[model samples]
Target: MTSASVPAAFPRAVLFDLLTALLDSWTSWNHAAGSEQAGRAWRAAYLRLTYGCGQYIAYEQLVRDAAAEVGLPESAVRSLEADWLNLTPWRGALDALRALEPHCKLAVVTNCSTRLGTQAARLFPIRWDAIVTAEEAGVYKPNARPYRLALEKLGVQANEAAFVAGSSYDMFGTAAVGLRTYWHNHVGLPLVAGAPPPEFEAPTLDSLLPWLGRFGLRPQTI
Candidate 1:
């Protein structure tokens, strides 16, 4: 089927999960881990402390593991994040938001402590209509509460919002809760083995413009 034939409804508010969507985080994680030798004693600390013992785990688990490997606590990790340069700006994210901002409402829905969430927004360098953090809701992604909290703040229904995330499980969790999900695969990462694909998937944010058009907002002709 042609791409235009797909179901691509623009959301009243684009609920963005902060870490990987707007800011590049993987490079920062690697850089931090590399600063020390194989994370020294921290590697064992990470592998042991994080709850999920299986092969495949959630994205947050990675953060915890990295913290442990660095001989830091999760609370400390939450307070310290890689510098902005470690994170590359998402390709076309700035452009898409500039285009979409005129027509649709936008907000951030991140899974982090309140302090970290606000810090992410400051670093993102965009003006959001609103920003909702997990700390406010006392929940995290892959759990329905965070997304629900974002929509609630927007004063919109779950179906009226489109939740975008970089992880498969997070995408699935958002979809299962009721909102349409757009998976931001910026790194060209492979889709997770068992998780169902999201309503949107693309190598870069530029692709989101076309789908945004279907929702009564199209990219500026320039």
Candidate 2:
């Protein structure tokens, strides 16, 4: 099948949540700064389970189990969760993404091993057109399964769906699938040093709108 045609104004469905959208990099999770030590001594024991068991484990469950694993009671562990749980959207991101909510169907697609895309649904309000997580797709970003599932879930054509990915890999992924792609360009990752380029480049997530407008959008009829 050919790409779904772009509407005159904008895509009726737009997916937005990336790790860059929901959480900042340089945060401890990626750092693993003592995840092992923290997993053993910290309040959440379950945090280590994803490593030992399946990747789809819940952070909350990890938090709960980590507490028990580290010998802290669940109540005590709950007290320190605010400091331990640091995943949240970047600064100014909410307002920036907000500008588009009124204009189109906003969705979130994530490569997280868990339901991180949906978990983000609570922190930011986009009134999503759809939400898809890697666990459901059985593969990570750059893989066709997740992208395919996301398009199916969004009910939009490949061309109509502009994939906004923070990393080069995700950009390469969606573009390969024939969907328009936006490299959110947060960390200045090179474009795979000669890989096929993304359709658009955004210095920051805030900068993607004008570029996305090129694709056009339609009023969310539903």
Query: Highest lDDT among the candidates is held by which one?
Result: 1
User: RMSD for each model, in Å, please?
Assistant: 6.5, 8.5
Q: Candidate 2: list runs displaced more than 4 Å.
A: 1-8, 30-85, 217-222
lDDT score at residue 176, model 2, on the 0-100 scale: 69
Supply the TM-score for candidate 2: 0.66
Q: Pick the candidate with the highest TM-score.
A: 1
Per-residue lDDT of candidate 2, residues 60-149 (tens digit):
565556556656555644543444345667766777568767766666677553544566555665566677776776555666667778
lDDT of 1 by residue, 177-218 (tens): 787777887767666566678877876776676665564335
**Ten contiguous residues with the weakest lDDT in model 2:** 43-52
